[model samples]
Target chain A: MAYSATVGSVRHVFPDLKTVLARASPMRSGDVLAGVAAGSEQERVAAQLALADVALRDFLAADFVPYEDDEVTRLIIDTHDAEAFAPVSHMTVGELRDWLLSYDADGTAIAALSPGLTPEMAAAVSKLMRNRDLIQVARRIRVMTAFRSTLGGEGVMSTRLQPNHPTDDPRGVVASIIDGLMYGCGDAVIGINPATDSPVATIALLQMIDEIRETYEIPTQSCVLSHVTTSITCMERGAPMDLVFQSIAGTQAANAGFGITLDLLAQAQEAALSLKRGTVGDDVMYFETGQGAALSAGAHFGMDLQTVETRAYAVARAFKPLLVNTVVGFLGPEYLYDGKQIHRAGLEDHFCGKLLGLPMGCDVCYTNHAEADQDDMDTLLTSLGAAGCTFFITVPGSDDVMLGYQSASYHDALYVREVLGTRPAPEFEAWMQRMGMVGVDGRVRELPVAQHPVGALAELREHAA
Target chain B: MSGAADDAGAGAGASAPASAASTEPTEPGLRVVDPWLELRRFTPARIGLGRAGDALATKDQLALRLAHAQARDAVHAALDVDAIRGALDGHEVLHVRSAAPDRATYLQRPDLGRVLAEGEAARLRSAAVPVEAKGGPAVGATSGFDLAFVLADGLSPVAVQEHAASVLRATVSALPGWSVAPVVVATQARVALGDPIGEAIGARFVVVLVGERPGLSAADSLGLYLTYEPRTGRRDSERNCISNVRPPVGLSYEAAGHKLATLLREGLRLGLTGVGLKDEGPSLGA
Candidate 1:
């Protein structure tokens, strides 16, 4: 479809024409004046007005046409009149240039009128006008001014925690990981565990790495934090050498603990500095830590559930001084040796309450194995929340495991309410009050009134007096 | 001839006795045609390959024909660099030489294809190197080109040959104000090499379209990788990717382009890349 071009210049129409000179002389109130007056301001004004009339007519008739099926044309046509046309004639060269440059008025009117105009069409029109050089430089300046008004900023940090087994499709695994990193559980962390380490699995992992690098533009380093294993090696070695070989080549597992810790530290420092430097006004730091290899008795890294909790608590305490925002808790090794229930019952409590300071938190790992029954999940969530957990990330039985995580997250929310007596408490103040009270140091403490009887309150007051 | 006819007649008469004595008619019919009795009547040469002599073909022949057809198609559809240049309106065409001398060589030598050609330095010098700001000189700027387009011959050349235009159109449509540089087609390239292309163009954002490895079900899938403030010496952690750009199994061009644009805009806004930007999601529709 053909569209009309919007021209902002009068010189393009009349190159030789300078400011118009009026031939008619102005009439005095008591005396009749006739003929053109030499250098009369009134005459000049009349001439300029006539020139402006011509320019306005030409603009309306030539430049302002229906660009799209929109209200802009109707508004322009309805608004166009002798009065509107005359104002342009009175404008000085500078004023005219400014008016032309400020395409925002015209553009906005057009946009308002043309509700059906697609973004592409709008872009095309904008491009065409800019290319024609008829666009007023003043409009450019206007845009520049308004651009600052729209200025807003955000920051993101992504990390991928590798899984224990080789997955069927590594690309899917990586996508899920990145998705988790972006919008999974609160704080945005993703975990992966492949079932085996066959060539197919390695290829899948590599493919996932490639996809993250290529499709998502995630830095290979941060996108994949570490590939983990619960056991250093499986003792059952037999005909399938690939599995054994994979276990032996567990490089990611070996390096995961240190790698993830260092990554978290670096990310935290970066986020903190970004906030400090005013580069990022808002900050959310995420970390994905797993204990897949910790499931095996022989593969213990001298840190059981309690030790992990204490270490996490220390880390959280250290980061608290820096005012880091958002910490995600991910649990791994639930499927190690086919979900044999290796960990103790109070495991989540130490980590969630004592360490992370989360009254309710999500677990990032779930596999379809022997131990992930509904009851087991309910018990785990309840104990974790009571001990201060808030979110649990569980995968579905379908091909896309992340969808399952979303489903499990809803169920987990319910479980938290049912078991821990903590509902979706948006107001932290109310939550703290419900819990009991806050100490002067911002720690949870018993309310003085609750702790003391009504008569004891008076006694305390009397003691203070 | 008379003796043969008489023997045939006597055999036919002997078969009737078997047919009459049997309780089951079907069993008697099979007994009458017993191979042991008929074994002396046939020769080995007449029994094998006699009914369908000319119809059968060997497996090797079928494989050979299939390979020939593939080779023919590959040659016919090989991208014409000249045609691409004409389409780009006098933009200098960059021919990235893979270390692999030929297609076979290219397959084995992925590293060779990742580097720019010898003449690229001079071409880059002659062309306007991306500047951070308009007044800035065309060389050695901190922020580079407003936009950069990188094309790679990933696992499948056919993918590049098929989807380049559509992907480019979608991308250009999404980015309204940015100045898009000419597309660079690289052979035998990997994903990590996009950093250099960004550096070469001095681009704020680098978008690479490459062929994805063909699966058993899909042979011509395309993939895209976009990075914000892509420059030389940037680590792999500073980029994001959009994979599976072909239809059915992956994102369509329009969707991928829109997402890429959103990512770039978000990255630029945040001054961060990789995992930081992954969660930002698309801002266009939202």
Candidate 2:
């Protein structure tokens, strides 16, 4: 409990992740090196596989069960003693909102309910009771604690740089990186989706992200959105394996689509952790899912896509992934076809994922062939931004050549920040200032001459001085 | 979507059996339209289902979920090859698996799903030409069979287990005396494996009946992929497809076979297949 802290209403761990670091025991990464140095070739090989299997099996189920105490749940229960808050219990939503505004204007009491209820849950439950509400609750949530590699040592809203490249085109990849970093993005992870399934092609993409990170000194993680097996291969082969990525569903068949088993997932976790990939401790995995994937995988077991999707959070949370996103409209209609459906599904996924205590984000997007337009994405983005979403996909001009769809763009992030008053992860915000992307007056600057290739070094240095 | 509706039913009113009128629109401020109910047609596609506030109505939600479950079941369902062969009683059969080791590997590594297991391929390759040639002209004299009907469980094995035999029966009936090779039943297969299987078996042309990815409402849907001078590495553009061979609602096996037979005849005559050749099965009145 000493490792935890409260920000507004939700409780979060101050989380140095000592337990995770300590558990890298029994098989210290050093043990493998030692065995290889001190044994026969076959013994060394056996030692390696044995350690790998243990690491995979060590995927702790405890992580998915919400490690922090549900303090907000207690607050929600306390409010149910209608006699305690009877003065406002019979009032209408708007009136209750206004009354709470006048009474607890700073919103401390109202913010306390946010971690307990997502927007949809709040909407459905607060119908009859005036005192019980999340419309008011949402307006007050200030601090959120989410893991994104080394980014969250405290509480904040964060966004990742999903600069997906078709065939890992370096120029296109670099352009999106430049655009995202300028707009104060990538506080979370700069994950990529590779065009080819080949493990070699995937490693090449991770190398690209690594080079960019080293050159710019960006304090974030990078990933090639390849399958987990490929990612594990990259880590083992000494490629930059910051976040191991995979697509997961609620059933065996869906999980099979990515060649994953419980043992495989655990192995992937152990593999990444063995490399000590995270500077912020064991938050190494990155998972993406769409609504109908469970059904698509033949593993829904009679549950709806939403419930099955929610169940996938258990898979995600198990490895303590730094980011878990729902690529909502990716599956197309017949599952969730139009913009309205996309918006509703996005909110539901975000709310459900957050309620289950994962760092939830939404890919506010539409395929060229889907029954959705940019306006639908607008609705989804704004709603999710207002509801404390953790991240959104931003590509160059919103067209992902690889995935062949349009998603939220860099400008959309600015729009959410401008309209909703949300800020990027604070460390990222500081970097934005240092690079002169956004200035003291809270207005974004043109990409500073200093940050451009054409800008003269002496001139830029004098300008800075 | 069906499951969502059931959830809505459970959430809005658990006791209502026949009518959802209790939770029906009382407030005139909004009206939720049941998209399908508004129309007077049958469609596998979901429509007209109105919203419960901003989400799907209870019935629509439950229906969607139900469709989803059925679709999942369709994909995960294994092809009952023995049952299929039994249904086509006394027919000689050849069983094969794609290079993919199992269902999981097949889904992830599709490249593996497009070829025959090496041993099976080699076995077919080594078999001598048929001793007897029957039906039509000798399509390929070097390899004595006119055709091989390869059955593959592509995305949904349910499609193969439920509909492939009936369709095969319809197909065989249509082509009365055509010299067909023993039917090749393949597991963990994709459409292109028809090429390797056909070439190995020494067939001049191949008709592959495989399962299509299950749609929300239509799970047991069968599809036919036709190829000429079949071999490995055939592009999708080079093959003609006769799809959605589900019972009752989709194309009947008789009709599907007619279309496939038409394509085979046309493709053989033209000495080519795929995009240039179109199915005039309807006009030809097979």
Candidate 3:
């Protein structure tokens, strides 16, 4: 027979037919199905072979035409790869006959094709044919290929700076105020600024603080002090200072919006740093800067449409190396246009062009002062990609609430799954550690520790005492 | 029979007695009710009620019924022409009238209405809006908005007439970020026709609000169809639908404004569509 040579060669390599036959019966349907519903391509082929064997046995007893051993072997060779055929090496004589009959091939021709004609050899050929038949089966089992449910209920941290107000507690209100402005209330603590002396400012500041504290029960963090100016002021005193610049001059004192020209931003950043040396310690400072204005509205501070591009380039380039961190709060149309134009002009090349660019660790805050939605998020993410900005900040409760959460979670999960390839729990723990937050495990070491902290801390305290 | 005759005769006798007593020249049984009628009543040529009653006994009465039926048909033809003209603008109309087994079959078989009868496509092509001079960006017409509006016999034609203008106005105002030209309204259009119309107009996006196929409970439903980057190459996945167009059940006009704006923006950004867009997660608001 044509298949005799192939069968003899296969049997010679592994001579354990009886052991394979004994294990065939009493197999659970789920196990058999799962074996066929394998993950890799190789496993899927093996499972198909097993199912074919069962189908052949049933078909042989029925009125269907019997399949020959050579025809069965031919089908197996056509369908499955040679290297992954070992799993189907063991099939009983009955299973082999059944597999052949199920496939409706000539059983007499198969017997004539085999030179040695051992029950083991015949069974193996039958298994191979069964694998081939799997392709033709309509209701074949299915195994899910993608991992969709892995990143459930994960939270992303996003930060933003609110419009500064007076009478805000510096230490206790900064976090909530920024959180409220970023995610829109309840997620973080906020502070009051001491700059404004008006009763209304005081009342509004107090009300916001009470509301946030009552809602989340988290203490507020102070705003950075240098962000306060005549047009824009930090809400709390003794808060870390960051520069507040505006192109709209006296109009800045009146709800200036977030629109600042690049030149003004650079000037403000420099000036604020200088002022910080006199009032506060020279610790590394955080800068939360943003630009705003109506896009169609006329440009202010000698910055017309023509000069805005060049000015923005200069400002971003200058601030690339100075600040500890920066959040570019872009509120309105002016910022949108500026962002698009700046990107088109290759400002990203100057700041983030190189593999080892100077501003490697900067965080971005891309907020729309207006109501934001999913479209806004897509646009912002596109812009961030264009600017080569890797890290993103998201405030909860923006437009596309669920989508925003999903996007953020999916992005983080993909990074872990595809890039790092870490398992879910370990990856989750690592992410929490990086964020300076605690996970479900209650342990709060700054980093993963090898030794127990109780023993080490106890010995240290004993020495100190 | 005698009792019936006696009742009729008694009623007639009471009225005729006064006339008979004062008649100057009257036949023996004929009572003259008026002086002018008395001469005519006595004349042998004058055959009043007796001759009229005899005329009703012939089979010629059926002929009058046929004449009335013909007149009714003529009136209906004229009314149908007027309705077609009003519905189709000045464009010639082609209708495929169906005699279905029942109303259920008519409602269930939307595919039957989608395609025009034989030679209808050709007829429609001849009457279609002419292609104007193509000026502006060098890209193909497919690069921008194709057919902007399509009309249909949704749940309620009245609702379409009422809310279509406002919805279009809101969509246009919100989409200032993109260029929009004149909007067109196609009468008797179907949802599937959106693709063909979009192809004809050379629009990148087509927004169609049509009357929905009404249910027993709701006869005035409206539906929205928005196809992005609309072109011959586009697939069904590229099109997004905002269904339940009427107020209350789904999106309101104001809410639809934001939703449409977001959909258009995403479509523009992604360029490609389908499960890719749906899986892009929820809309801007949700």
Candidate 4:
């Protein structure tokens, strides 16, 4: 059926629900490249207006990708929590937005409603929200998870110490890890993006990090961001793995492109669980998502990029992951185009993921080809910090030599922690305190490397060797 | 670099308890040198740089900014057409522009970069005719050349300027008696630009040598894309890519050319390029 909206003497028509949702999205280059973007500003505003009145229940009836054709669509329909969604089931998309921002929709209320809200409903409501609205609504909701240390609480922000190397050099990776640890980073997890995507290389890196964790007794988890299949292979070889990591997407086809399936992810999760690696909680999966992944894979099924990205959160939601990060701006200029688009997309991903009951973080990063810089990242970092994002990917000097992109530096995380008045995970905070790295105020102390016992460069040499 | 050395010297001597000033702890404006700074020899990653109160030291920050600036410049830099044409003086070359009119448009609208501008396709189609076709039944035009090479100034034009011509020269030298078409140099182009160019030339295969997106450490990394039975609207799944083709830091010109030659030989023999063809030739260990 056609959807129509009349605005000031101009009447616009959209062919179907998918068209309405696609046209209603904020302008992004990927949407334009897909040939589904609104033709003009007038058409865009009209679509948004038409989308505002869409009943929340309408999303259940209109399958963007057919339920039979896609496992993601089937997952959304099969696992919905009707009891949690009872309160807002009658609300329109605009009404849902209003209700989310209302005084009554506190943390507890939103947490209860998370399981009931489908990805499409959350995406529709996000479309009607401004940047401030997105942040304001998201800040009130908290989705906490844990493995060795608890994450996501009031006045808490964590950092993923990403010590990536060009050739997966063990010394280089260990050196960067030590650099971040000195700054009181790596609370969320110490993950690596291995240069070589092979099982042998992955096992070597995993064993190295596992040795570090065991020797230091740091209260944190570790992951090697390889393919789920590779992680499974490592598991079969009895490699010391903490969190099973994979790059997931919104559509079934996109996940297939990454050589993954829902069943494979479930199997990997069970394998990780069988190891009994967690100390605090059982959430063991670590997922990395981005907006243009499905579109880039050519598996978006003619849906808008943002909406498709939201669907990926549903996949993460089902897994009960400890960390779900949006690697924004890494897709380059064709998907986002500029700093403004990346910044906005980062917030939207966080908000939608949090709304769907998932622990949401962001890799506030950019490639050289994208029209973005550290200043833009600082803006997104500050904004997401205020919005209570769970964690961020922090590297040495903010340069990922392996991936060839810039992300939040270990110092950048410190800057955010200082300015936002937030602290790290409680367990990791206590460990840092024990090492004299952070003071009583939970702020990292300014200790000379020669005086501080663990701050000495000799410690790294001993560890790496 | 000297300052770092001085700091290292100071750090070593201060811990010896020889100077009374050492008891007072680190002085203001002095960087607390990371003891593991010497470990930087193991990898190129920026590690063990001492910090100044939860921030990068002035020297390290400046070094990072310089690298970032070089990478950004590489991304926006224009392909040096005259120099490339000069480098390939002995070989026939054809120059054309994509539908994208300028650099900014080329970056934002990749769709425009995949198709030729008005009349550019006609020029390529007309150029497809072999000299013998003027006398015969146009069999060479229908059968087409064995392969066509395209040089596209993708994200990092610096890569194209530095390594594209050299790699192309090495690749052509490897294949003798092959009916290779006049090399097409496209500005404001993407990988798929080779598809339409190949289709117009009626070539059996198209090999695109385009500049890869610049990374902070390596600004001039070239990428090679090969497509068999090239045509418009081909999915990326139908093509094979050999990435990071820059010397010393990445795949060298000789190795990259050798690998491409192997793929072309294998692709022609296998009747495909994408998933069907695997680069099982001598591995490029670098």
| Best-matching candidate per DockQ | 4
Model 4, chain B only, scores a TM-score of 0.81
The 10-residue segment of model 1 chain A with minimum total lDDT is A144-153
Candidate 1 residue A161 Cα shift, in angstroms, is 28
TM-score versus the correct structure, for each prediction: 0.32, 0.50, 0.25, 0.90
lDDT of 4 by residue, A1-465 (tens): 788999899888988888999999999888988899999988999999999999998888887889999999999999999999899889899999999999999999999998898998898899999999989999998888999999998889999999887778788788788778878889999999987888999998888888888877899999998889999999999999999998889999999988999999999999999999999999999999998888877899989989999999989988999999999888777788889999999999999999998899999998777789988999999999999999999987888777778899988878987899989999998888778787777678766556764555446555555
List candidate 3 stretches off by more than 4 Å.
A1-263, A274-314, A320-351, A354-356, A360-390, A394-407, A410-465, B1-163, B166-286
Interface RMSD of each: 40.5, 19.9, 49.0, 11.8
lDDT of 2 by residue, A175-262 (tens): 4565566556677788777657677887777777777676666667887877777777777788878777888765555676557876
Give lDDT tens digits, candidate 1, residues A1-465. Answer: 111212333212222112121121121110011112214444434433443333322333432223353232333344334443354445433344345445543534422323222111121122112212222221111110000011100111111233211223433342233222221111122333434434444433444443333342222221122221211111111111111011110112322423333243434444333433221122222232232222222222222322222223223322222111111112211212111131221232222222222121234333221123334444444444443332344331101121111113322332344344443222222333343433465333322221311112222221211
Residue B34's lDDT within candidate 4 is 42
Q: State the weakest 10-residue window (summed lDDT) of model 2 chain B.
A: B5-14
| Sort by lDDT, top down from the best | 4, 2, 1, 3
Q: Name the lDDT value of residue A4 in candidate 4.
A: 91
Residues B1-286 of candidate 2: C-alpha lDDT, one tens digit per residue: 1111000001000111121222234358865442223120221112122224323456754654464466557666788888988987867777899888976556434567787887988776555245264334554435457778888987778888888888888877766546777788989888888998988887878888888765444567788888888888786678887877876777897888777777777776777788888877333323
DockQ of each: 0.01, 0.03, 0.01, 0.31
In model 4, the runs with Cα more than 4 Å from the true position are A440-442, A448-452, A455-465, B1-34, B128-144, B233-241, B262-286
User: Backbone collision count in every prediction?
Assistant: 56, 27, 59, 0
Model 2 misplacement above 4 A: A1-156, A448-465, B1-286
Say which prediction, candidate 2 or candidate 4, comes out ahead on lDDT: 4
